[model samples]
Target: MDTPLINALEALKKENRISFHTPGHKKGRAYESMDDGGIQENLYQYDTTEVFGTDQLQDPTGAIKESQQWTARVFQSPEAYYLVNGSSAGVLAMILSQTKPGDEILLPRDVHQSVIHALILGDLTPRFIQPEIDPQFKIPKGITLPQVQEGLEKYPKCKGVLLTHPNYYGRPGEIREIRRMTREFGKILWVDQAHGAHLGLHPQLPLSGIDAGADLTVTSFHKTLPAMTQSAVLFAGGEVVDRERLLEQLNMHQSSSPSYILLASIEQGTRHYAKAGKEKMQVLLEAIESFEQKFRRLGLFQLDTAPGKDRTKIWIHTENSGRTGHEVETYLRENHGIDMEFSMPQGLLALTSIGNREKDLKKLYLAFEELEETLYNKVKMEKFSEKYSKEAKEGFFEKEVERDKKEPLGLPIRTAFYSRKERVSINKSVNRVAGSAVTPYPPGIPLILPGEAITRGHRDQLLEYEKRNIKVIGIKAGKIMVVAEE
Candidate 1:
């Protein structure tokens, strides 16, 4: 029987698009020279149900145990668990394992959507700590030590501090300093190191979460390593995180019938990292540096960078290309046959990994060159400030929560998410307690949480997002559904 997913993937291949995007493998062609000897095929063979030798993921005792042990060693962590559900699972697990209901946790405003869901799931109050945003590119940067200190001073009762190291844009924060602050404040340091999975493998790269004093760190192995999609790892460090509690939470959040294919991919990817990752990543870095030199010469786009950020993930914003990220993404895919990892309103990003080769980099350079010529000759440069500007000057990172006298429209997210609920419009949602969390997708943090009073600022942001076709969850009729008074 033919599967729809498989058929669709085949159709995509038929389209012959050049993948500048993900799996970091780029159509599985870039890593062909690696001495896999078809070990990847062997891995596929073992992707079976939990048999006699294959152990269950939740209670690993056999091959899974060995794999997890190997992974721990690879990352230099006290222990590591292969997460079949992606880094999102590991993040949620950390939150659930560490905090209790009504407890406060310090979270960076620029964190992924998963963290917001985790906060709602755990019934924890988030003390939002803003990240530093580059004035030029409007890209969010890492939080500073002073900011962490101030947050800890203000919210001393916070149970933990959740930070994203090497944020989605590839800006690496000073993790060591942040970790020190968290420890001094007697709070756990939970790092979302989704983009830094390859850090430990390369000595020249920025430090990994495990090495930088993070208590519990989650990495999306699939993002930067040669792992299958949805494969991730959660590393436990120091005495901050209770390992047993983490294991229990992981079992709860992770799937019982875990995919052995994804597990084996992690195993193989870790082994690859242990053996040849350094040399491979070195070559990858060299290729990127070379590409940057050529990219600067073209001069149609400005590549955003921050001090101490990992150089592998290159984020490009057009200077006068007069195109939204959507338009540039379309131009690459339709005209140049190239696809990138993500195209936000501000810029387009290309994630380079050990999986990339000289030829792959060359192809990207050629595409950019063509893109420059096409935009210069055919497209009139459109100023994007008016189109992409934030709805309110209320800083994305620095916004403060104000308590309103309005009654809640719905129960807290913890209850509303698990309960049967219906959608409502934004205007009608004013007095009701929110039944769900409504957030912006790219940096998926909730603008409105369940049980929080809906302010006009929140409404305006949602409306602006709607105008731009940005989707918001837990709402109906341009309003959000909330718990009604019985």
Candidate 2:
């Protein structure tokens, strides 16, 4: 297929004086990678501006528009927009475009921070529907039907229902049921499917948000598909979404000087997936299942529930072997030179995407075999013996949201996000209203949000996370940010 966007960039490179445009890099002169020879040259050479022939992102008609059309067809959406800045931009644009200021929206509490940002920026009120927590993994699974129905009932003025399908752990929910309910209530559905870019491309994967009839869906192609980091696509499906407003917001959220390199990545990646995704996914699933069999036969590792999951994600419970997820993460990196996606207190996430080679799976099996031995010995030395933790066998995840009793939800997120704030000791911050979100970086879910009263539970969680070397954003040096007292 003709990669129009990439061809345009290559043609510009042939022009030789493309530097006369804008990007001060001047095509690999000052800013080449450490490699300095291969794709680095082309990468900088094609870094371009909205010159005469190159179509503008805000108003596309040429190569850029053509690339988007190809992407839409492949993703099974009526309309698609390339996002240079990642799914965050799409998320903010979708919310602000669909809902009026002060309009209520039903959402899961486990939503990405970008959703919280949209709530603040768009002045949209949120009625949080807590997602069902997996007791064994402690990670939030899919949102339950009762939770969504209750939120919509409590907030009768809700204009839209926003959700995350195939959550961080690859748990696929009843997206079809949610779609049916939203349609019955005359509410638009917006999905933040950042991690489900490969959905609908393969039969084994879950139904995509577009397939589930979402009005607007945002996907980060970088998450699962063969794409560069920060590349994403915004899918518009149902007629409920206003294309004009979506486009306007897309233009507003993104920068004028969008990266040609990123745009070409989306185009090139989409082209490849459209042709070969099904074959690739089939092979990947086979390799993953083989590895799972190898691990299960040994009976050394505790595997997560697989009844409803994307299958590409590999989550192993380390608690059984008397190891924290952080410890396992460190072991994988330091011992095997393999960096994993994310690790929680009880489980570690290993992602298998189109980037993996069959040999990579082979190596992964070997590495985990070695890891299993180390964990067994550690448990033995600690007097836990050859037996695994019984709780781990069944799973040990947090089942529900344990709200802080003292610090109740105080103000709207928008008001508290903009309020004057001060940083205080983590202990002293208790009972004060939060001025900013304090979220764990990997999951990006707010443990404490702006306008929520900080309680003892919040303080303890942050402090424990601090000890574990986990990143807590919106805090300064060891202190938490809180609304300053007048």
Candidate 3:
């Protein structure tokens, strides 16, 4: 069979690489401990639609309703809805349901691109809140209490606030304080907790959005939990949530025929979390600590101990090692057969979960040692300056071109997105309205949003990212789409 994707996947599977990434089952190893009735082995047979015994996802009444109710209880939400389209659909649904067309919503600048898409879909205006950036990581850390207060105060008419808890490297902000402030303002607080499904399972971990008093929350079961990809759950709590409207939005965004395989995995994952997830998380945490200790003793490859850091996310700094994180990631893959979640210029993030074994940590540690030795022999640590070459470092501007100072009343996202646009060279696009969002995946935060005027800073940063081989979503060739003048 001429199945390149399948063949490649099979070949990758044959190599038996240790996973520190997601769909958190770690290639279905977590399923081995489950007492599932051969469902893991025969998942294909259960892939049927809304027939006799099977229930509809759109308007759940039978088994699906019971399953959702159980999950809601497990997560301590007043209501829970299963989503097979992943957290993106849940995010869109949350936005559309909460705000009317042209209504404004308060959100962080570092929100996932899906939130921007929701703005386009709902014709909603975004009141952007600026999160404090990690000086070392060059990524937005998380929204602070003052930032949320200022955002809400500045955009008093905005329907509510939206935030991503434990921003991608798994560091949580002051969510409880932010939640209290949102409540005092008599506004809704919606949380995009896509990377935090395993939170609240352990006391050491940060509280889940539902637990932190968010009016609405969406979590991906597949990210840090043992579930099939594309499975997520939308949680609704507090008096502010419009349950009926939220359900309608879910129906609109989700597929008519949801995958039974995904639904089954969500259910199984819920059971696993309730039954065995806690103990396994404890073990994973201990393993992570031990792994960090090895590097700590050697005084190499420092682990990120950012305040309120989720120890599960191992952010190993390679800045002093004379190799870029991207370079280290490739070396690990080629030499050690170890997979990482993502990499920035400074470091690689290993998204450890309950699925990861102690042996996997040991393998990663050994790989790190080898990488350090290789780098030490080839290049002097002092000689390798600027993180990524000097030019690249200068190009990777930390600020967002005074985005925080800009008013939220730029051209509406939908208007600019649907407007007639023409492709122009990246250099020529400066000062023109962006026709689409230019985002970098892995983190998936937009650098240039639809309706925003492209700045010289945006152009320069994007060109540098391209030169360094970073994937920019909206660029094709060396041009970008800009709103055409009449």
lDDT of 2 by residue, 1-486 (tens): 689999997966665431211121224331221122233458876788999877989999998998899899888789899998899999999999998889999887778999999999998888877676666656667876677788788898999889888887888767889899989889998999998888886777888898987899899887777666678999998887888899899999998899988887777668657776777778878888888877785445566656868878778777656556766777666566666777776778877775565666677678778777766556424423323244345433231135312244688888998999899989898889999999888878778889998887787777767876898797678898899999
- Error (Å) of candidate 1 at residue 85 is 0.9
In terms of lDDT, the best-performing candidate is: 3
* TM-scores for candidates 1 onward, in order: 0.86, 0.87, 0.94
lDDT string, candidate 1, 380-437, tens digits: 3352244333422334322222211223334555776665656677755665566677
Best by TM-score: 3
- Pairs that collide, model 3: none
Q: Which stretches of candidate 3 lie over 4 Å from their true place?
A: 35-37, 298-300, 379-410
Superposed Cα deviation of residue 273, candidate 1 (Å): 0.7
